[model samples]
Every structure is written in structure tokens, then in C-alpha cells.
Target: MAKISTTLLAATALIALAGCAKKRPAVLPPAPAEQATEVAPSGSAGDVDPNGGPGSDADFRRSVQSNTVNFGVDVYDIDSTARAILDSQVEWLARYPQVRITVEGHCDERGTREYNLALGDRRANAAKNYLVARGVAASRISTISYGKERPLALGSDEEAYAQNRRAVTVIIGR
Candidate 1:
């Protein structure tokens, strides 16, 4: 009877241990290779270099008032401020017709990954459409949505969220 009780207690302990096993967090799939491109280093919007070489990333960043445009929470609409920034980008693109650019859409860490990805796509297309309408050739532009994966700022606060929710125009090639 003593041996049987010990075996039962051991079995119960094993069951409890099994129930307490840790679970691995869900992993997201990798982004596509074809969609990847080298992004130019970020800098201040006012750091314009009038004598920067033509068709260069520095030229693009300098000639344009800003390479990024921020959006409101859960909103992808282009506001007046975003329009002004895109206008600068359009003007720069006109100066270098051979250049190709990618507009990367990003989001803050608020919603599900799927929801953020869709929203990011819309934000990117909105910027691309605006640029195309303003005379930047459609063929010269491409867009990718990084969703909430690539954030400009990391925090749960409003300030960080504001910075994270943006579309960045990257000069891919000339």
C-alpha cells in the first residue's frame, strides 16, 4: 500500500508539471525578399543641402522638405501637412526622373498584426497616389507595408504612437 501511494503521488506531480509547461510565443512569418530594399539613413527635415549631388539619396532628402509624413490614430487620410510634404517629394522626383522610390507604410503597436498591415498598405497607397497625381510617374514608385513591425518610436504613449504612425519615402535607386 505504501509503494502504491508513492507511485500515485509521483504521477500526480508529473501531471502538474506537464500542465505548467511554458508555451512559446507566436512567431510571424518573414517578409518577402523581393520587397526588401536598402533604406537611406534618417536625418532632420531641415537638413537640406542645396549643393547635394543630383539623383543621390542625400539630394532626395535635402531637396525634399521631409521624407516622412505622419498620420492620425487609426487614420490613413492625407492631411494638409502630409500633402505639403508630398508636394516637396513630387518636386524632387521631377528633378530626377531616373530615380525610383519606395514608400514604406508603418503603424503603431495598437491593433492586431493583420489589421495594422492592412492599414499600413492603405497609408502607403495614399501617398503613392498623391505623388502620382502630382506628376511623379507611377512606374517610378513602389510601396511596402511593414505594419507595426518597424516602428520609428517605441513606447505605449501617445507621442511614440504618433511618431510610429507614418509613411516614409525611401529612395531605392537612380
Candidate 2:
């Protein structure tokens, strides 16, 4: 009789615990629409592609000096070096008015996930704001933060950390 009672109690506890488990939702939100417009072939005579064709990612990279800007440790301020790089980006963006870009912020793998994410966001915004201030349209840019989840350099040394702490501008559409 005691064995039967103990078995019954164990089964009841197991069922109760199973009932507490939560089910994840199946539906997901739709992706946002692309912000850039297609470039017309005869839009402007001066808008000729430097490489081969306008509105291509390769053209944008080829036109700009650099697509990335590095930040100091735990800092999001745009220094003179970063400013120069973004200025070049702004000039390239001016030539390709229909182009759209995404600025991705990243950080070294030292801080907590939450902290790094926040820092990364600030870094991305800093770069975006600089571009907008220098005549790039605000609507043509979007920002995302990867924090320390995506590292340019995998090593744990200071050099690797410096490389990892950066914001990269990616040509998304045109």
C-alpha cells in the first residue's frame, strides 16, 4: 500500500511540472521593406559607374577609401581619423543619392552582452549621425548593433580587441 501511494505522488508531481512548461509562438513579424530605389540608366550623365555599373556594392567600395571606422576602447566618439573616413563615405554617398546603407556596430568580447549591445548601438548611431551631418540623407541609412557577437578578430589580445571595436558601413541597396 505504501509503495502504491509513493508511486502515485511521484506521478502527480511529474505531471504538475510538465504542465508548467511554456510553448513558444509560431508566428513571426514580416521583414521591413528596402529603402533604396533602383537607379535609372539615363538619370544623370555625371553619375557614371567608376568600375563598370552604378548602384553595385563593388562600385561603392571602389569609390570610397574605407568602409569601416574603428573606435577607442569602450568609446563611441568620432575622432579625427573616424571623421576623415566618414567624410569620404559622405562624398561617395552624395554621388550615389539613391544608395542605402546599413551601419553595423560591434564591440570587443569583454563586457556583458547587455552592456556591449548598448555600447554598440551608440557607436553605430555616432557613425550614422556623422554621415547625415555631412550631407548624407538620414532616410538612406539604418543602424544595427551586433555587440561582441560578431568579432573581426578572434584573438583575446589588445590588437584583436582594437580590431573588433568598430562600426562597418555596408551598402544595402540602390
Candidate 3:
């Protein structure tokens, strides 16, 4: 009985090995599903404008034109500068009442993070305040302070730092 059992076990092992050894057919998987496009060739990420094309609100590129204000002495301020930008931003926004924008306030890395954050906040607030004054609905604009976390010019030089410290206006959801 023991010899018969041993022989059966050996046969079973051999059968399992044979089954595993058979070569399965190599299959070329089907190509991934392609996205449809408008105006361009099919299967492309083409120009299906989010705002339905030019002269639309979503299609408008929010401009961040810069202006410098003298705050007396060499100790100039960016808060007022931001306010000017926001004033213009509001005017443009009024034309497209449905548009939303975020005011990103940044500063040079000369100061501590906490101080910079506060300063950046003030800067954005200044802009927000100006926008409010200029007849822009407060809800249409949002503010954020980068606080030197993201430097426009990555260098220790004053020139670079000056450029780094700025308020940028960005367009939000359509």
C-alpha cells in the first residue's frame, strides 16, 4: 500500500509540472481607450475651449500688469503696489462678472517665514481691499500668501529678491 501511494504521489507531481510547463499564447493587449477631441484629429487632446473659444470669460487671460508706488525713503512697500494691480484686475473682472481669480502674494526671502507670511497676507489684503473699493464683488477674488516659499527669482542677490517679492494675479475655475 505504501509503495502504491508513493507511485501515485510521484505521478501527480509529474502531471502538475507538465501542466505548468505548457507555453501559454503571448497576447498583445488592446490599445488604451483614446480621448475624443474637437476641431483636431480624432483621439487627440485638442482645443475644445473651456470658455467656448475667444472673447469668452473662461477664455480670457487675466493680466498681472505691474506698477511701483513710492512709500517714502528706501523702505518701499508692496501692499500699495498690489492694490494697484487689484484695482485694474477688478476693472477687467467687472467686464466678465462670472470670472473668479486668486491673488498670490509673495515676498523676498529676507525675513522670517512668519513675518513674511503676515506681510504677504497684508499685501493680498491690500489688493482685495482695492478691488472692493473698485466695485469688484469681494467673493470673486481669493487671496493667498506664498511667503517666500516659491521664489520667482532663486538667488541671494537684491535684484533677484526684488523680483521675487511680488503679487501675482491668477485666473481660477471657469
Give the number of the best model, judged by lDDT. 1
* Ten contiguous residues with the weakest lDDT in model 3: 29-38
For residues 1-174, what per-residue lDDT tens digits would candidate 3 score against the true structure?
A: 999999999999999999999676434222111212223333434232344453232344433344321121123254555556556666666766655656666688788777777777666666666677788888978877766677777899977777766656655533
Candidate numbers, best lDDT first, in rank order: 1, 2, 3
Clashing pairs in 1: none
Better of 1 and 2 by lDDT: 1
lDDT accuracy of residue 132 in candidate 3: 75
Residue 139 accuracy (lDDT) in model 3: 90
Candidate 2 clashes between residue pairs 3 or more apart in a chain or in different chains? none
Position 3, candidate 3: lDDT: 100
Model 2, 1-174: lDDT tens digits are 999999999999999989888565333222222344344466665444424476556776777888889999999999999999999889888877877888989999999887998999999999999999988999999998888888889999999999999999977665
| Shift in Å, residue 157, candidate 3 | 1.1
**Clash pairs, model 3 backbone:** none
Off by over 4 Å in 1: 1-52
What does the lDDT come to for candidate 1?
0.83
**What's the TM-score of every candidate structure?**
0.72, 0.72, 0.57
Clashes of each: 0, 0, 0
Question: Candidate 1 lDDT, tens digit per residue, 1-174?
Answer: 999999999999999999889665356444433444433344633332323555666687777889999999999999999999999999888877767888989999999888999999999999999999999999999898989998889899999999999999977664
Task: Report lDDT (CA) for all predictions.
Answer: 0.83, 0.83, 0.58
**For residue 162, what is the lDDT in candidate 1?**
97
